[model samples]
Target chain A: MSPSPPQLSPKELSAYFAFTEVSSLLRHSVEKQLKDAGQLSYVQFQLLARLGDAPGGSQRMTDLADGVVYSRSGLTYQVQLLEQRGLVTRAPSPEDERSTIATITDDGRGVLATVFPGHIATVKDLLFDSLTADDIEGLERVLTQVSAHLRANPPRSAGSRKKS
Target chain B: MSPSPPQLSPKELSAYFAFTEVSSLLRHSVEKQLKDAGQLSYVQFQLLARLGDAPGGSQRMTDLADGVVYSRSGLTYQVQLLEQRGLVTRAPSPEDERSTIATITDDGRGVLATVFPGHIATVKDLLFDSLTADDIEGLERVLTQVSAHLRANPPRSAGSRKKS
Candidate 1:
């Protein structure tokens, strides 16, 4: 016999529903903004944003996948697309030939600068506008705790992928 | 010159990052579980779940799209796939011949029964485990507020789509 489904309290169920609903709505709004403002997908925006924020404006492809919680092959495809668009370039890492590093180009930074205003506005209008300061604080605290727990057993982390 | 980007305070920035990261991670985990346990995509599972929850195990195709925050074309394709799987049936509504109504089949309910244990457990492990009761309360409150605001100007609501 199959295991019994776990019971969730009414409050827990409503919370989960609300959380997923808001995430879906907010993501949709931001994705539309990114597409309109810079013709970038959310994943592409995340890739460029992460690389742009890196200390040297670059990161290993594997690290990029881990940071964005994306699959390696999928990340490679996105990087290739970015490269074709002249927004980023990839090269073998000097310290480790097996690893590749991706660097955001000047064009990539330009795209970020282009889309950021609309992106920020969409986020602010859809999410932050409804939140009070206390709500924001609580959101940060709860999500940070949840993030740490999820990262501890990350599905796409280099260590996790090593086994597969 | 392009308008300057909206300024997000440091705390607000961190809160947004934490929210997106946790949602991504949680979604990834649940998607993996749904695939492993039932050969269902997250969207398919959502469709079935929504149908199951609706009165009489049915809903209008347009309403399904709006409720799921999915595009009309995309939702139609998913419904087709589910129909092919014998999990749902699409029929022209008697009251409105132009509109299609989707009804979940017994097989769809069976699939839900099969996959829900793992889905609930995944949600609990990846999300609820990280939260205190107070955190859950705060999460629900803040997210419910955000959802109401976003829904007010929803991008894919029937009224919005008519304009497009």
Candidate 2:
């Protein structure tokens, strides 16, 4: 006989999956929004915008990965692609030879300048415009709680637990 | 020039970019959890499992797509891949001739049965285990509120603002 499916109480279900749904929708909305101005993905736009603001338009790869929610390797791969496109360029970090630094090319900054206004507007509508003032404050507080807790208790065996 | 990148209020910055960090880590954790055994992506597992629970192991493609959070095109592509694997099949919908129905095969059920238990456990740990009871409740309420708000205030423009 097959094992019984573990049932989550409504509260538990709401607590766990509900927020993921919102976050996922937000990403989808963002992705769709980005597709309008140009071919750039949301992360690509973010990387360009960040680099445009950083000192000398450059930052270490590790910091960029953290800011963009990309895995280090995944970010490296994407950055290399952007570099090849002449959207950005990479150089050996002056601070650490072990690290690579990425900078937005003039072309990249120009693309971002073209794309960012509309992108930010979409973010406001899809996210901020939907929430009441109280809702925003409440959500910020809860998310902060979640962020702190997740940092303190990173998933351990959780990753491998779902494999057959 | 061009507003000097404007000083973003702290609240806006945190709300816009910060949660992406948590969502990224959570996705990494889920992906890592599901890589071995069958290498089933979360959407694939979700599609198979949802179909397994349907009458005749089938559901309309649009309904299934909404349930699993994929856009219609994305779900269609994924279902085609599953069909290639002989895990699912599609047919004309009887009640709605314009719609397509998706049906999971025995192999799909077998795969879901093998993977779902650990998936739920991992979800429970990756999420619930990291949150306090109050935090959980707070988050659920916040998400429910946000979800409803978004549905009510659908974006009229795809991407045109530059606030975030």
Candidate 3:
């Protein structure tokens, strides 16, 4: 405030903001595209789409939460919303009823099938469009490192609960 | 809502979901860390931090909006909130009264100083902890391309109303 604080070196700040903007735009674009397939947020779409492919077409809710970026309760709420929409079914696991199992419904797969082309196109246009076949190779390489770093440290404990 | 349907190959889904999860988690980690820096959403922190070194300690609201990932209205709203907190001030430029120039205040710098160390530490922990210097360079490389792509195709129409 006084002498005017120095800016983050352009190099540091650029990477910081790059992750933010790229992800936000990607999320917005993907969500918009998914809506045309069904009234699904990206989270909802990911959840159903994941369950749609499990060996038995089902997974524990905890497994589902761990499988993606959403938290347990947040995912449960979305799964409830999806259940209401008839895209997925949630029922207690027979072996361990404390946790529910989520299964994708035929309707969910139908919607996913309906939306797949647009979803792929949107992802390609917004993300892959800007990358080369080599850039994709580079992205995959760096993303693996990043994904491992994040998984190893896992931020839910240390991250924001801003509304509070 | 009948039976299970055939699905995309697991390898394909793995690559697809990996990209989404890693990107979202990294951004969330960075933003969450900023909360401790005094309610700075990652975007807000980036805006204020960037403006700290803007030429003449001021920048056009539209330029500021483009500098960060936020929508023009989103930028305006957050700048107003920061102003209310006595962190920044806006002056209508004589050159373009339609565009306001925002300057950081001493009080704002104090807040940033207090918060930045921990934020950087978190970035290091969540992002760079496991990586070699080379990995960092690779991430920088890939993200630069992604950033360039996003900036080239910003979502809004150029002739849209000024957010401020």
Candidate 4:
């Protein structure tokens, strides 16, 4: 076992607890909405939404995995599920025969359109409703800083390898 | 189809994106650490930690579910797993014979002690290292408000009934 680390400052512990608890609650709320409205899991919704927003309505599978922070094999299974549902289509990339590109199909767009209203409502009701504009700004600034730092120096345990 | 909702203000979108992304990355990082070092899933670790922190180091099973925002059946399963591992013990609540209480065992405390250093380091390295004192204070204040509001008006889709 590693030696005991120094105690976290009260501020650090309090801030972390609040951040984690809020994140968990928010995810639960969003996941329930997605499931109820679209029969979609949260990660599935994220993949569809990202593909819907991408240029030319498609992205390389590797890029999509990175964007969602999902492992390559895990993402492949998700994409396969979506393809079977006709919500997305995967094809070989034009520029690289070895790489695959995933595009949201018309069915995918329709599901997004159907689910968007409820999704937005849930987000607004559970998250934005309680946040003041100033609080939003502060959250954005702090989280952006923390995110960039973590992205650049990801934990070794995350196993986030970039596969081309 | 429902009518399109109004667009979120750019600030709202930006803030929510950062918040969600940060939350996701932090969870992945923490989960990896817990899995690697303690052979525990994130939710399992949460259950143990919360039980460890409760008064008398025990809490009603229903209360644990609410505190962790997990489904009743799901918490029951997790507690059963912990019990099999000798990390937690569940007994009928003395004050409420109809309810069960979960308590962390000495072995649970030992696992916590072993993994806590890595957990604290991961948190500090990924989250708090970049945050200023003011950022920490602001985050705690804003998230506390949001968490309370969401807890009071949780999403209908969560299906969080208090089962005795």
Model 1 achieves a DockQ score of 0.64
lDDT tens per residue, model 1, A74-119: 9999999999999999999999999999999999999998999888
DockQ class, candidate 2:
acceptable
What are the runs in model 3 whose C-alpha is more than 4 Å off?
A1-14, A159-164, B1-16, B156-164
Q: Which parts of model 2 have CA positions greater than 4 angstroms off?
A: A1-7, A66-73, A84-87, A95-98, A105-110, A152-164, B1-9, B52-56, B69-73, B84-86, B96-98, B105-107, B152-164
In model 4, what is the error at residue A62, expressed in angstroms? 0.5
True contacts kept of 3: 0.33
RMSD of 3: 5.8
Encode model 2's per-residue lDDT on B1-164: one tens digit a residue.
Answer: 23433333467557666566667667767776566545788788778878988989999998997677666788988899899988999999888799999999988888776776666666666566656677667767777766676666654454234545
Candidate order by decreasing DockQ: 4, 1, 2, 3
* Model 4 per-residue lDDT tens digits across residues B18-123: 8888898888888888998898999899998998899888999989988887778999999999999999998998888999989999999999877889999888
Q: What are the per-residue Cα lDDT tens digits for candidate 2 across A25-134?
A: 77777777667775788778778878999999999998998677566888988888789889998889887799888888889888887777667766666667656666
Which wins on TM-score, candidate 3 or candidate 4? 4
Residue by residue across B1-164, what tens digits does model 3's lDDT show?
A: 32333343344344456677777787677677678557888777877787887876688898887776457788889999999999999999989778799998888888887777777666666666666666666666667787688777765533356675
Model 1, span B1-164: residue lDDT tens? 35656777777888899889888888888888899788899999999999999999999999998898777999999999999999999999999999999999999999998999888988887888877888888787788888888878766533364464
Q: Calculate the i-RMS of every candidate, to one decimal place.
A: 2.2, 3.8, 5.5, 1.5
3 against 4, candidate with superior DockQ: 4
Off by over 4 Å in 4: A1-4, A160-164, B1-4, B160-164
Q: Rate the local accuracy (lDDT) of all candidates.
A: 0.86, 0.74, 0.73, 0.86
* DockQ class, candidate 4: medium
